[model samples]
Target chain A: MIWAVALSAGALVASGAYLALSRDALRAVVGVSLIGAGANLVVLSAGRLDAVMPAFVPEGASRLADGAANPLPQALVLTAIVIGFSLTCFALALVMTIRQRVGDTDSTGLRAAEPPAGADGLPAFPDDER
Target chain B: MNADLTSLVVVAPLLVPLAAAVASTVSAGRPRVQQAIGLGGAILLLGSALVLARAVAAAGQVRTALGGWDAPFAIEFVADGVGASLVVLAAVMGLTALLFQQDDTDPAPASPAFVPLVHAFLAGACGAFLTGDLFNLYVWFEVVLIASLGLLVLGKERRHLDGALTYFVLNVVGTLFVLVGVALVYAATGHLNYVAIAHATMADPYRVLPFVAVLSVGFLVKAGAFPLFAWLPATYHTLPAPALALFAALGTKVGVYALLRTGGAVFPTVAPLMSDLLGWVAVGTMVTGVLGAAYHWDIRRILAFHSISQVGYILLGIALGTPGGAQGALVFALHHSLVKGSLFLIAALVCREAGSYDLRHIGGLSSARPWLAALFLLQALSLVGIPPLSGFWAKFLVVRETLVLGHVVWAATALAVGALTLYSMLKIWLEAFWRAHPREDWQPPPGARPASAIAAAGLAAVTTAFGLWPEPVLRFTFMAATVLHTRP
Candidate 1:
């Protein structure tokens, strides 16, 4: 079980990195979300998965059972998931805004902030330069 | 202070800003009310931070477990001297940024969320400084990340959208790296609290080196170190003067503080193994950052690159991994925060008076606005590490430490960076203040308020005061460094 989880997490991360390096802005955002999910899985697998009992103490007992699952990783993963979801939403929204405003979705084409060099090899100023 | 009072004081720096965020959001439509609430909250946060710093100074450290839970189970908020001082720095920057923004004419149009997001950013920064758990630190970092992204997009300009896209993507990846690092650390040590991790790692440092490396790389990305700082200059130029000042002051310093805490304090045994590599990274950051600054003509981009270079000096101090090195890092962080914040604010004033952020187009400020010129000169000299200023003393300590450790090449690189830093400052002076304005008909803006100048002046005064009377800050950072070196 551990081997399966680890291998899947590794694959997710590898594919995410590949997509994130793409020139398409939207694909890069999706790739970031994929990497975030893969990281969440890594956090989840940090706690052993073979526990027989739930992470609970018996009635009136003082402590959790020996084979009980660890609850901390679950809580951490929950927080990570929430943060990742919000960030992905924000990134997607930002990409949409970029598309509407800049009229391009290529990550390499988003040089409105730092314009490319002019024909003379000097830094070019955009029309709306501050 | 009593336990309850101490706990309240320990957490107040975080809660004050958060409460202000909520209040500001509720009063969003009314810019006046939001400004009032924001400034009032910042003042209260400063007060609380002072109290916390005082209590921690007296007791060496003050801590509390949330909801009255014990240390190992509940999340912890621990404020030693280092954390307390940083909290104080955040409060000061928050107050200054709010003051600078209050009466500015260049407000973010139609953006009622700006003030709330600033408060949220402050809250996250304070939380990161105070949290004792690694996972909690990651959470605080996300809070900072989300808030910063919101701030970057508040203006909704095309450049803002472009910049925010890169900032959001890069910083999210950095935070995910931190998440994986946290997970690995917890798996190895079975604990997330700093004290517990320290104890666990002390037994077998070699086993945890890879995890520490991952965490350090994540933080280095956030700190805008070499080869990972493309997002910094790409995005920071998109911010308004006030927001830029706040980000310049607190954003990367938080990452540097994290590096110090983990490397210099939590995992001392592993630190030695990593010090050589970090030292070289520091050199690379310094050289590359200065070179980038030299190539830029935009005042904001130049200062942004300088921010990266100054961070290299602080990282050098951390990379040294000695008591003296930590002391130098803490001192440099504080000094750089004040000086760089003032420099960005002064740049805004220059834009207001001269009509452009491009240095090539704006000039004659010395003849037109003498007082502003004087302020810029003082702050610029401080940045260049001239005599009797805060930067000189900061560089003195770090370079002296490096030389003492027989790393002559590192020390020489630091000094050479200082010279190149001076060159960049001179470029700003020659282009913006001394040379003639490109357009003969250019005139200063009308109805400009004194508030921005006063804000810049206030920060310059603090920097000058610290330079003149370096004993108190020096002693405070010394004690803070001691606290960091010894395990709880």
Candidate 2:
């Protein structure tokens, strides 16, 4: 189970990295979303995989019996998922605005903020002509 | 059982900002109500921070285990001198940012979302400072990141959005690595609490090296250290004044603070192993950052690059991994927060008055507003560390400590960077203020200067007063260092 989780996460991250490196901003957002999901998987899998039982005790018992799963990582993953969802949503919204305003989702076309570095000594703005 | 009150105090700062964020949102349509809630929350944060600092100073560690679960099993918030000092300073910065935004003539009325976002940002910053759980810190970092992203984009244009995109991408990557680092550490030690991880890693150092190394990447990128910091210069110049000032004060410093907190407390045994490497990174960061600033012609971008280098100076002390070094780093961190923050606020004023951010397009400010020029000179020189200023003692302590450690190269690099920092400050002064106006038709954009100028002057006063009365600040930071080394 550990090996399976690890291999899957590795593949997810690999694909995510590839997508994230693209010039298109939407692809990059999708890439980060994948990476975040993989991170959640890694955290959840760390809480012990041998146990199939729920991380709870009998009604009158003091604690869970041996081989019961750990609940902590589940809680952590849930939190991560929520935060990740919000951030991904923010990125999507931002990209939509970029598409509307700049008319290009390709990062290569988004030099409005970072103009090409000027001549040897001085700096120049991409919007300097305006 | 006795810790309940202390715990409440510890969490008060966090709760206040959160409540403020919510309250301001509740009253979102009324700009006046939103401003009141935001400023009121900042004031309350200051109060809670003072109480926390005092409580933690008396009690070595003020620990609050959530849901009554103890250390290793429970999520916790721990406050000591270092974190408390940062909490207090965060409140101060938060208030200053609010004040900086309060001008009547400003074209854009305060975005209802802006004040609330600032509150949320503070909540995250304070949480990150106070939390003892490694995983919990990652959650707080996200809060800070997302809140700041919202604040950065509020009322911004297309050009600024481009800059914000770079910031978002890099910071998201940085936090992802931090999450991965947390998972790796948990897997290695089977613990998420900082103190527990420290015990586990310290006992079996070899098992944790790879994970700790992975974790340091998050710190390095967030700290805006060399080669990893292109995003900072690319993005920060596009921010409005209030956002820039807020980040200038506490944003990147959070990364430096994390390094200090974790290195000293959780991973002290392994910290020394990376000392030499960190020293080299420090040198590279300082030199490259200053050089980056030197090449910039704009007012804010130059200051942004200088921000990166100033962080390098703080990291140098942390890299030394000594008690004195930690002391120096803490002192420099606080001093730089005030000095750098005030300077950025001044840059905003200069940009407003000059009608442009470009240096060549704006000049003659020294003659027009001598008081502003003098204010700029004081903080700028303090940033460059002239004697009888806060920065002088900050640099003196760090460089002296490096010399004592017999790292002559690091010491020399520290001093040389100081000279270059001085040059950069002079460049801003000469181009933006000292020289004659480049065009006869130009004048400051027509508006009466706001009372927000008082906030900048207030920060300058604090820096100057700290410089003048060095003993108390020094004593406090030394105590902070002692707490960090002995406990963390």
Candidate 3:
């Protein structure tokens, strides 16, 4: 089971990396989302594969029994997933704004807005030209 | 046990700032209340850190196993000497950032949002330092990055957007690797606690390689090592004065502290080879960083690029893998946080007065604001490691340790880098302060002249105090070094 999960994660990361390198911003966002999911799953799986139940022991049961799962990773993954989701949402909004302003979402095509290397001081807003 | 009270030092750093962030948000339009809350939290955090520092100095170590669980099970907070010193640095930076926020008056009110974001960022930083678990460190890393992204986008500037995009992409990639590393470590060891993982890895050290690779990628990227630091110059240049000041102060030090904690405490044997690889990266980082600093005409961008180069020195000292080297690196890290943060704040004030950060447009402010100019000169001099300054002491420690370790070649290279750092600093001084100004129609806004004095005076006072009376900080730094280098 662990081996299968690990393979799935590897494949997910590879595909995500490919998508991240794509030209479109939306694809990059999706790629990040996928990567986040895969990472969470991988971390969750690291807590003892043979365990059949969550880490909570019933009253009168011995602590850290032979087959109970560790719940810390679950808690950690839940926190991480929330944080990752928020970051993705923010990143997506940013991408949307960039597209609206710049009129394109191609990652490669977004020209850096810096003036040429040796430009004089900050230029006045074009509207101020009049 | 009552030992849980020790967790207060660790928890307060995070909780107070978080509470302050929430408070600032609820009081949205009232900038004064936001500032007061933020400042109050920072002062309280500083007091907590000082108390912790004193406790650590007296006791050998202070341990707090969180959630009523013991170590290797519960999320632990350890306030060893090293962690205490970092907490102190965070507190100082927190205060300086608040000062910069108060003095700065950008067209867009950055203080309202900047206050909360800084609080969150500092909390994340302090969490990263104090946590004794690998996964908790990753959590803190995310917290820092999220807050940083918020600040990056808060002030709507075109260059900021551009820089933020690059920085965002690079940092996300770094975080991804850190996640991968944590998973790998967990899979191999079935433990997330620092001590348990350390023991597990020691039993089967070879199994740790994959995780180590992933973890190093995140930290190395965050530390602004070469080939991965292209984002820093552009991104940092785009941040507002207070945000940039905080970034300069504590953001990258998170990576330094992580590398130190993990390398020395968890995986000492493998550290030497890793440090060697890191040393080469440091060399590359310094060379490219200085070259980039020299190439830039804009004052802020120059400083931003120089930040990467200065981090290289800290990296080199860490890479030496000796007790003295680590101590020197710790001292350098502490000193750099103050010096760099102050310099960035000074640059912001210069831009405020001159109406631009571009050296080409601005000139001859020496006569106009002698006090600001003098402050700038002092900071600039200290950055270049002039004798009787904190920078000199830091540099001296690193160089001496390197020589003692017989890494003479790297030591020479570091000295050369220092010379180039001086050269770059002088270039900015000559161009921005001493160069003749063509009388432009622009005049500095009212009250812009004293801003640099405030920022510089704060830093200069600390640096001079430490430089002249090195006994206290030196002792603290030594204790910190021993905590990391000595085996339990």
- Count backbone overlaps in model 1: 0
Worst 10 residues of 3 chain B by lDDT: B103-112
Which residue segments of model 2 deviate by more than 4 Å? A116-130, B104-109, B445-447
**Off by more than 4 A, model 1:** A117-130, B105-107
- Tens-place lDDT digits, model 1, residues B40-139: 9999999999999888878888999988689787899999888999999999989988888766534444368878999999999999999999999999
Candidate 2 per-residue C-alpha lDDT over B260-355 given as tens digits, one digit per residue, 9 for 90 to 100: 887788888878888888888888988998998898887778888888888888899999898899999999999999998899888777766765
- Please, what are the lDDT tens digits per residue for candidate 2 over residues A54-102? 9888898898988898887788888888998999998999999999998
Tens digits of per-residue lDDT for model 3 on B1-488?
A: 25557667556666777787888788769877877788888888889888888888988578778777777888888878888888888988888777756653433354467777888898899889888889889999999999999888875555555656767777888887788788778878778887787777775566687678778878888888888886687677667676777887787899888888888787766576577788888778777888888888878778878888888888888888887778888888888888888887777666666666788777677866677788778777777888888888898998898788787777887888788888888887777678766565655667543443565578767877887788899888888888787776
Best by DockQ: 1
With a 3 Å backbone cut-off (N, CA, C), the pairs that clash in candidate 1 are none
Model 3 residue A9 CA deviation (Å) reads 1.4
Give the winner by DockQ: 2 or 3. 2
TM-score of each: 0.97, 0.96, 0.94
Error of 1 at B485 (Å): 0.4
Q: Please write out the lDDT profile of model 3 over residues A47-93, one tens digit for every residue.
A: 75678776776789777666778777788788878888898898888
